[model samples]
Target: MKEIYLVGGAVRDKLLGYPYSEKDWVVVGATPEEMESEGYRPVGKDFPVFLHPETGEEYALARTERKTAPGYSGFVFHTSPDITLKEDLLRRDLTINAIAEDCQGNIFDPYGGRQDLQSRILRHVSDAFSEDPVRVLRVARFAARYHHLGFTLAEETRQLMSSMVQEGEVSHLVPERVWKETERALREPSPHIFVEVLRQCGALAVIMPELDNLFGVPQPKQHHPEVDCGLHCLMALEQARQLSEDSEVLFAALVHDLGKAETPTEELPRHIGHESRSLPLIETLCDRLGVPKKHRELALSVARDHTNCHRAMELRPTTLMQLMQRLDGFRRPQHLEQFLLACEADAKGRTGLEQHPYPQREYVLQALVACNRIQARDVMEEGITGKAIGEALTRKRVSALKQFKQQFTTQDKTQ
Candidate 1:
């Protein structure tokens, strides 16, 4: 008899009426030869996985796992005709992900996954959940993704995660795995929750000590009513979520303020020149995690120039042009826009200013438009050569920027 069950996120998402990206199935009591004979392409190496001929969905034989050593790679898996779906589900990380649905649409949840899902709780499937340190990150990611749905980690699951951290399991996590989880977390609706959950479970210290160190650092109460650097980071991430869906903006918002953590204790609530201080920190983090170039570049720009972006209206035309050049605004306007969004998140992340308008963004953007209006070809057409042309181009752009600033002031006065 052939027995196949829709499993993992497919079942959980269908039950919750959410759209899932892919479907995974567990085949019980099905031999490899029989699966291949039915036109299922063999794809598994460590276990029996095949692709359906028509749907291209993954179907893996029911398997059970045991901890042979440390880390996620140390697991010893057993797959045979005797392995039950219950046994396979027991090896899963979260209860909500362990539920299975049959072809006849019957639900098979022996571990109370349905109850946990209905309760909107993220509960561990078993003690073995702690065996895989990656599961800690997965739980936090789930909290971030489902935060809008009122889903939270179960106390037992949190305790297990904390234990895993204490046992040094998180220290063995590879950089690529950490980055993969973090990148996904940054795209979640409530990315800040991902950081908070990891910090709560002690995984942040192991995976990202620099980020963890920001927790107790002080900030000026007048400018940042949140008062703590870590909370400010969370607020900024939330603001970024509201401003843009671009993960580059989100990543920049999260790490742009990290330099405040390195501020001297004698400085107290004042963080002068923290922008420059953030540059090395950002580089080290990106290097450590192998962060993508786009995210790394935007984060560096936000860290180095966010202060200038916030003071857009007050800057001189020359200063504005220099700022634009620093961000390579002429070549990559999209990155500049992302930089502005990150800066806006920083300005509005304060306790009472979340909904405040950030017109500085438009102010700087207008300056860019003014500069672009003085095209190099137009400057070249003016009969100059060598270094003279460069100087002339700069002069023309500066004059345009000044006029643009005056026009902005005039419009503001009339409005």
Candidate 2:
């Protein structure tokens, strides 16, 4: 009584008309010995999983899991020839992921997954969803991926997530699992929804308290019409998505204003020294989550120098050269572009300002181009040598920036 069926994301995406790359299969009434005898390769470390001989796609045997301890790794899986597809699907995290399709184009959804999908809802399969803390992050990621399709979390599911948080289930998630889900969510079309959904479910407080702390904090209304620091951060993340598809840039934008959360009560809405305060928070968060070095570097740059980027038109030539040096922009020009895009997102993410002009981005780019035109080789060709050579190169770069600024000013006056 062996049966093979398509399962998980491939089946869900196919039904939704969304393009998906990989397909997962489920095998019912099949044991590992039978699978190997049939030429499938054994691969699952925790349960019964195999690889198709020709296609190399994953095929996991129908299994059920039982909670033995805390955290996502505390589960004991039971797979046998008697295990049914419905039992396997019941252990899934969400309803939309529990539906399965046979090779004959027959779908078996014992869990109302099709109804939930059609209704644009992300609902947990059962109360057993609370057994694994990673489901919180997965639900948040799904919300982010399908946000553009008008999907929303079912209220009951949100309540369950909230209960999980209250019962301390979310606290058991490891940093790697949290970051893995977050990185995937960052690549989604509506990444802000990931954070928003987590916040709504109270998981943000447990997983990313630095971000959660921003919600009630207020900012100057005139400058940030969104007013709430967290809302502004989410808006900035959305804006970054519109500007560039780079996840690092989007991450920087999402966290550019994190320092505002630490602003002293006396400062109220001004957040005068929040930029410097943001650096340590960013470093701490990055270290805790094992974020990639590239992401941490860009986030640090945006946190420290984004204000300078916003005021690019007014910064002196020497200051501009120093800014470029700090960003290592002279050697890594693409890094400069990422920094500027994140800054631009921050400037435009405010309420009623989504379409506002950000001339600073182009101005900074032109300044970089101007500085780049004065090559070190050309400077060395001027008979300059020794330690003074670096100094002399800096002077030339500053002069070139000065000229670029003057030309920009002249062009501005003409218009």
Candidate 3:
């Protein structure tokens, strides 16, 4: 058996001038036994995966076969010496991902994948695409990533996704997998494509039912020129993308105002306590999605504390310091930057409306910097224990530190 080269994504990314990351190699000529004989250690128990001894790169000796099971979870494998690289490429999710390069760098285009890539179209490998519900999410994510590349879902692929959604195949997908795709899509350069794809495929309802409520929900004309809450959210998401916010912050921004769709409103629509309402909702959703606890906390913090920005600005320095102190001494530059990004996304979301009541953005940033300095230099380094700091603040020094912060701010303003 010849070792046919079938390098997939790395080749395509190279052709597109994008950075190639995480090279995954699939070997056709080697069996599990042969791989072990060649000094490749078996890694996967359920599947045949190996690691090269020299490069430490993972290589999967996956065989090709038709599915015997109904859903993506049901697949039969055939690991024989006869499997070709062409057969393996045909099983991929999309045409753009199916094209392979050989050892000599000769590109193989058996299924017209190169043409699809050139045309920037996202067509399924075959009608069997519906077998894998995850492909539906993958298509949406690819749309988000390659929209500027002019990629459009093929008609058949769209129909297949619609059918899968209608047939309840979406429920077969694990929450973690769905959340992974959704998070990735939200972090794309433009998530509008992904949102639009979901809108078309009816997959949003299964993935994020909160967002589904946004469809056709009217917003006040004055503030939102876009009319519908869903459209407005799309616009806000686009703005968030432009700001280059982190995935967690961006996801929070997308869903921060979701409560508005559920809460009752009149002609002058209002979502009182939407930020607070969204906090628990996000927590539950993130939990279901199996988001990491730290990330969930950060996103929930952004969602919950997002509404406090305007209020925080009006408080005295001491009150602000007390609030910051309540944040449990988690002082870090990255934390502050993330907070600023969340605040900025929230403000940008409210553009075209009444002016925000918060102190100017620059002023708040300066205050944050000053507050961080005080906490890092004085409060943190005090060698006096937490109990001591707590006692000092409660009794003798609270008022003094407040006075010091005030003086510092006043001096800063003067400078």
TM-score of every candidate: 0.98, 0.98, 0.84
lDDT of 3 by residue, 296-391 (tens): 766766666665654665666666555455443235545545555655666666446324433434554555555444332365465667567655
Encode model 2's per-residue lDDT on 1-415: one tens digit a residue.
9999999999999999999999999999988999999999999899978999999999999999999999989989999999999999999989999999999999999999999989999999999999999999999999999999999999999999999999999998899889989988988999999999999989998888898999999999999988999999999999999998898999999988789999999899999988899999999899988989999999999999999999889999999999999999988999999999999999999999999999999999999989888877887899998888889999999999989999999999999
Residue 378 in candidate 1, Cα distance off native in Å: 0.5
**What tens-digit string does per-residue lDDT give for candidate 1 at 295-381?**
999999999999989888999999998899889998899989999999999999889998899999988887888888887788778
**What lDDT does each candidate get?**
0.91, 0.93, 0.70
Locate the minimum summed-lDDT window of 10 residues in model 2.
Answer: 371-380
Give the winner by TM-score: 1 or 2.
2
**Ten-residue stretch with the least lDDT total in model 3:** 353-362
Which is the winner by lDDT between candidate 1 and candidate 3? 1
